[model samples]
Target: MTHRLALLLLLIWSTPLRAAQEDPASAALAAMHQLEAATVALEEAESARDRVRAYTNTIRAYETGLAAMREGLRRAATREVELTRRLSAQEGELAQLLGVLLTIETAPTPVLMLHPTGALGSARSGMMLADVTPELQARAAAMRQNLEEVQTLRLLQKNAVRTLNDAMASMQQARAGLSMAIADRTGLPSRFTEDPVRTAILIASTETLAGFASGLSEIASGDIAGMMASISDQKGSIDLPVQGAVLHGAGKADAAGIARDGILVATRPRALVTAPTAATIRYLGPLLDLGNVVILEPQPDTLFVLSGLAEVFGKVGEVVPAGTPIGLMGGEAPQIGAFLSLSGEGNGPERSETLYIEVREGDSPVDPETWFRTDKDG
Candidate 1:
């Protein structure tokens, strides 16, 4: 009996130890370290072009790592709770088993055998002991499993904290590199001057998006003929001016109940905004309630209005090549707090710094999603 009990204890402890060897958290931790290396590469990039590419790679890596870490933490927390409950139950079972053993050791063997029920009572008691022993052994095995789970969960929690800190630091460095890249480009000449009187009239007379677009169409200066691609041909192939997720697509009602004529993209704070195609800037500055705006006319009949900019680069009527840096988004880095917010995690609010993109064909609002390459379209 003693040898069997010892063997059960050994099996209980060794089984969980072997099972605990398979861990997914180590892979997540390794990815985070790779992201840290990418961040270092971004910081060391020499040219504006290199910096841009490196920054994008680093951001992507950090986002991926952050997501992995968050998932790891969540799974660990759940496992910890489950193991804690199992441990409590096993402890209770152990205490009961110990009490039974103590009672058996204290009571006289003759008393147990010569009870009132005599031989029948002794037979029943022996049967009960035979059943309880296996139950006690099972409970002990469960306790060992719970202990291993608890240890694994602790390691996961620690890794999550370390990864989060590293991600934050990488984000800060990437933000700084983006700022420096923006500052390096200078001397973009304007081809047309802003018509202040006309702009004022348009702002005061227009109330709806369609009206505002029409009003701008009348005052917009610059002949885009032979300078850009045909807008109709580029449908579904054109890239967005900024890299981000589409928060509200065209014809969708925003939180204010206003149906947008364009798409709103939620991006990191101070993210570099670029020209999606070869277009001449027709209008640059604030208009109505929209923040600083940049109007680009890729063709005579097509116009793209980008609003909610914190700063405007290039001058009015300046012709820019495709992917030219135009401006930066408003606010600080990690705009909406953390990458977890991108996945709708936590209670933190969504990013308020949105890039509003409006595409118009001859004064009529067209759905930007139909033309631009959004994630949903892909």
Candidate 2:
């Protein structure tokens, strides 16, 4: 009976001893330590901006380390179960031995205590068996606790891996987009503003020139209707009126024609014409105070024209689009003109120089200011 008890004790004691030797918790503990250290390094690198690559590398390293740790824990768990089964068998055997020893003690013929050595050995053996049960249970609990902790850590590590990968991708894409924006310098002039201006000129108006002449004829008597008749009514190219180039000095515009000498010889920049969508003045001429003028009729009722350039694009009956650069300021020097026409008064001096840009819905000239976007501020 004593021998059997001694064997049981050995088995129970060895179960925990074997676990201690293996140190099942060591793998999980080491993994956590590595994770902790790596996380700290990652944060530091992110703060410095100098170690982003290293930080990414460390994150991947953490994943590899964690995976290895989990594998170790799985192996340890298997060992733990084997140890637990051994412990159970040893415990059952020990219980049976103890029952046998108690039965001998309770016999009516009081059994004499065995020799000191034998009794001491039996007592020591029983104590050993008893001590190993709690120790084994405690150690098993500790190992299981460590296993659970490792499982939790595995979950956390997985989340961390995903989050870091997403962050890296986002950062890379942001950098690429910034690079693209820097490459395109949109809407800027091709040449420097300091470059000398260039221009082209085309003369097309006959009625405008005649009206200009009629306005200039202050000598015409009352109403001046009969005098205008002598200018001819031919609408064709036949009997084309002679064209004149008059150079005047800088001046202002009011009611009677270009004030004195307001015309300055200019080279004026080219005009860009776009398709029309609204009513606008199709063409204007003779670089006036504003410059050579041309109106774009995008709609039937609206007339839009610029009057500060020496050149105009598109002629009568020509269609232009919206927002086309119709004309630009062009001049070797500044120049100006005026468009004035009298109403009830017969070529009155007060009404001859007052140039008006009007919008006509049907037959009337409306204020042009309502629709014009002036470069005054531009």
In order, the Cα lDDT scores of the candidates are 0.65, 0.35
lDDT of 2 by residue, 1-378 (tens): 133333332332233323434454554444434444444444443443323223333333343333333433444445555656665556665566556555645755423433357879767765775676566556556655655655654554444444444433433332232233223313321111111111111222224422322222232223312111111121111110001111232244434555532232222122112222322233445533444555544443333333454344333333333332233333221111110011112122221111123333344343332333222210
Please provide TM-scores, in order, for all candidate models, with all chains considered together.
0.61, 0.24
Tell me the spans in candidate 2 whose CA falls farther than 4 Å from its real position. 1-22, 97-378
RMSD (Å) of each candidate, 1 decimal: 12.0, 35.2
Report how far residue 91 has shifted in candidate 2, in Å.
3.4
Candidate 1 lDDT by residue in tens digits, 181-240: 555645555456666777778878878656776665456455323553566788888988
How many angstroms is residue 53 displaced in model 1 relative to the true structure, after the best TM-score fit?
A: 4.6
Leading candidate by lDDT = 1
The candidate maximizing TM-score is 1
Model 2, position 249, has a per-residue lDDT of 28
| TM-score of candidate 2 on Cα atoms, chains taken together | 0.24
